[model samples]
Target: MKLQGTMLVKENELYIGGVSCKELREKYQTPLYVFDEDLVRNNCREYVKHFRVNKENNRVAYAGKAFLPIYMCKLINEEGLCLDVVSGGELYTAYKAQFPMEKILFHGNNKTIEEIKMGVELGVGRFVVDNYYELELLEKICEEKGEKQAVYFRITPGIEAHTHEYIKTGQIDSKFGFTLSNGELYNALEKLNNYKNIELVGIHAHIGSQIFEVEPYLDEVKIMMNLVKEIKESYNIDIKEVDLGGGMGVYYTEEDKPKTIKKFCEAIIEKTEEVCKKIDIKVPILIIEPGRSIVANGGSTIYTVGAMKHIKGIRTYVSVDGGMTDNIRPSLYQAGYECAIANKIGEKRKNQVTISGKCCESGDILITDTNIMDIKSGDILIISSTGAYGYSMASNYNKITKPAVVSVQNGKSKLICKRQSYEDLFKLEVV
Candidate 1:
């Protein structure tokens, strides 16, 4: 397996952030989520440095849904990146971390009344309103508070980005945002004219997640810029911002080829400037809410091998102590991943094995038909590039406890999130 972020190998052993894998396993135990702190900060710096349309007003909001532990929030704040939250809990996490309220952008398709109230009360920077109902609801909430709230209308540009069907959000059939092709967005904008407490500051659209190309984004920019022109002509509302929401792809396995952050940012900046110049509008403040690309490659999940089963000419199943409970992407999206025996790095890749999780479901498989170094019971298995959705989307299915999370930097490791205890599973249960 190829190494990423600050990984190095010495004496036939793998090390991440200068700490040996065996050291991490010994200190944190098995089924661990490891993050490289320097890598994450570097990614943030890359965006802040390269993802510039107008350096004065453009923003890089780190989508908290990728992995929003409180520490992560603090790290993002420390790195000078804004936070993009999709739920109340994420916003609250940022609040607990003392993140600046004006740096928060609340987003969701079906945001509840409580969440809207929370965002308003907390003075969130912007609300990416999804539907007519949400727009009306936000107006009501802001009026009740006697506050003027900034907002962006999340519209579907009808661009079918090449990705898994489940993650495609920009298509016309998606459940997110007003559909741009059908005049729903125009109607929404018209309705916005009647509201007093809401300020329509921008337009937002997310094409999809794990997207691999730049052409679709370029198309999206043209369409959005045209819409911006029309909105100015028809509604007389100058769009101060345009959020081309993030779905920048990252490497998961050898087959994946993702663009560097520099290239991606340069392309976006040039395109936004070109489109604005052509359409005769001031270049709006550009924003990209990159989530996975910042965290995925910098994180890895380390699990301890438990059982192995081999059936003649069928498959070799290598079971680990953790599964769908900790990382559900493989089962949810059929996501591909690569792994290696941390302790057997130099061994010959003579084993063709399917890595299975400890979950009860047969579909709880992690990797299928992958060639890895020979594995043995008690050996440590580390899956690469799982930092994004693995912990953020984790569940307690089958009553399994989540693993501990640790961030590594400069050969030192510190636990950020503790491993869930059995008591944690039932702590909130009603007697």
Candidate 2:
């Protein structure tokens, strides 16, 4: 993976914005997540620049599930990007960050009544309604509260993109959206049109995550355009927007090649304009919810080597202080990652080993079969391209406290999140 912007490796040490990784590890201790603030801002600018060049009424909504904290919300808000929250906790985090309610887009498959009511009360920018039950609950809440809610119908375009099955969400048989094979989508649109409180303003579709190709999005736009035509013809509903949910892939390994965000956006705009022209409908506003693509490559995880074990004719096990508790991607999706010893960055590859975490389970492996150079106890290992789901999916597994997070920019580093303490784990426990 290409390490761009302020995050770089210098003199056998990782550096972010002129600050060395060794310095960060020293201050924050091992098992740390360090984000390059300048890199993230640059990424945001790249997206906005491309969208502006296309002259599309576009909104870059930061997908908060990747890594969300009150500080992140503020950073995204400062960059002028909207927020896409999937659960009540995410929404609350945005709220705590004092993010503008008008720029928040609520999304989820199964939203509880309280969540629906919360959205209604907060007057969110839009709600991406996933199922019939959620639609019903939204209508009920809006009706009782005498409010008009802007909603987008989430549809399964059935275009299966090449990605992990556990992360794929856009297939026909998936649990997320209204399937296209059945008339369920049409029926739901009809029902939504008749509802007094619901205003169906757009259509939303997400093919999958970690997608590298453009064909899936091209296919999705076609399906959504057809649905838009049907909705206009049947109900005379003038859809104002079409959200092609974000799944643009980023480089995780040497073999993975992903298109630039600018190129991806241009393709989407071209296809959307073509489809809308063909259907004789106005081009709707384009919204993207990019989570990993924006931030995944902008951060890295730092861990201190705890032990090293060599087995003859088998493999060497290099263990770190943190395991699945800090990063669940490997365990969840069998995700592949690349790492370099922070203290020995320029050394030649002298050993082949598997990086293991300090956890009880056998499955708590971080990287399997990785090439290393002179790994030893007390060396610092830095995992790259972990900015997305690493810290967000962290747990207190085996009662291991989560690590601290620091944002580096312009030769300076500031702590954004504090390391979890042992007392934090027992605070919620009952006697």
Give the number of the best model, judged by lDDT.
1
**CA lDDT of each prediction against the hidden true structure:** 0.92, 0.87
Q: Which ten contiguous residues of candidate 2 have the minimum total lDDT?
A: 48-57
Clashes of each: 0, 0
Model 2, 419: alpha-carbon shift in Å? 0.5
- Write down the TM-score for model 2: 0.97
On TM-score, the leading prediction is 1
Give a tens-digit lDDT track for model 1, residues 1-431.
88989999899899999999999999999899999898899999999999862365789999999999999999988888999999989989999999999988899999999999999999999999999999889999999999999999999999999999998999999999999889999899888778999999999999999998998999888988888999999989999899999999999987789999999888988898898899898888889999999999999999999999999999999999998888999999899999999998888899899999999999999999999987899999999999999999988999988899999999999999999999999999999
Cα deviation at 25, candidate 2, in Å, is 1.2
Off by over 4 Å in 1: none
Count backbone overlaps in model 1. Answer: 0
Give a tens-digit lDDT track for model 2, residues 1-431. 24656766787776877899889888889899989888888888888877652455588889999999888999999888899998889998988899998888899999898888888898898999998898888888898999999988888888889999998989888998888788788788767655888888888888889999999998988888887888788889888888889999998888889999889988988898899999888788888889998889888998999888889999989999998999999988899999888888888887889999998999999999888888888888988889999989999888899999999888888988999999988999998
* Worst 10 contiguous positions by lDDT, candidate 1: 49-58
